[model samples]
Target: MNDHDLLETYEPVLRFAKSERFFPMAVEHYLERCSILPSGPLGAAGLLFHLNEPLATFIGKLEGGQYFLRFINEPLYDADA
Candidate 1:
């Protein structure tokens, strides 16, 4: 995706992350780390972060205990499951 599209897509996620109710500190912590990482890995992390719980749970069925962790930790690993 283009930079503008990427930025636009993250707008809502950012808002949610900032909100006190849905405030997941781990996500914010990861964002801080992601700032220094290369774009590709950051993008993958961001994609995983945006996945809702049900979707994340579904992805976990792909031979990983958690989709977000697996996706970010082993992105290059075949997603074949």
Candidate 2:
């Protein structure tokens, strides 16, 4: 079988709870809604990209350090409601 067919055959199914408010989304949409942060011990916990920036621009700003994305600037769902 081809690589694509093989991988697809082995792909696992995912189930989500009915109460789940979030699901997989496009990287562009996710990047626009989230902020980038530096990870690891030497990396300070701060916002590296706080605005709706593109993935290419964000990658260019990386300085060979471990980094992660956070949805701190916005809420995925209204928990207080």
Candidate 3:
């Protein structure tokens, strides 16, 4: 699947892209690491442990990135650098 589709499918894991804030950590790092995850429900269960943030925040973090929040301006999309 494309990056957007892959990411959308694994929304749960992506949400924990910043678990440092006690953000929902994954049941297992293998299925949660942003650099990994197989995609779909398996990926969701991985990080669907303690996270409790709104899904919109996750989308905003992915689409808007630094534009919406500076500290969490993570790169959710492919980039040249």
Top-TM-score candidate index:
2
Positional deviation of 13 in candidate 2, in angstroms?
1.4
Answer with 1 or 2, whichever has the higher TM-score.
2
lDDT of 2 by residue, 1-81 (tens): 999999999997889999997788776777776666667743443234435556546565555577777766664656756
Each prediction's whole-model lDDT (CA): 0.44, 0.65, 0.41
Q: Using TM-score as the measure, name the better of candidate 1 and candidate 3.
A: 3
Best by lDDT: 2
Q: Model 3 off-target regions past 4 Å?
A: 1-38, 52-72, 79-81
Worst 10 residues of 1 by lDDT: 62-71
* Candidate 3: residue 60 Cα off by (Å): 27
Model 1, range 14-70, lDDT digits (tens) per residue?
Answer: 454444643445654544333222235544564465454444233323432222332
TM-score result, candidate 3: 0.19
Residue range 1-81, candidate 3, lDDT tens digits:
999999898876434444465454343442333332224554445435425644333432332122221223365455745
TM-scores for every candidate against the unseen true structure: 0.18, 0.49, 0.19
Error of 3 at 2 (Å): 49
Model 2 residue 40 lDDT score:
75
Predicted structure 2: lDDT: 0.65
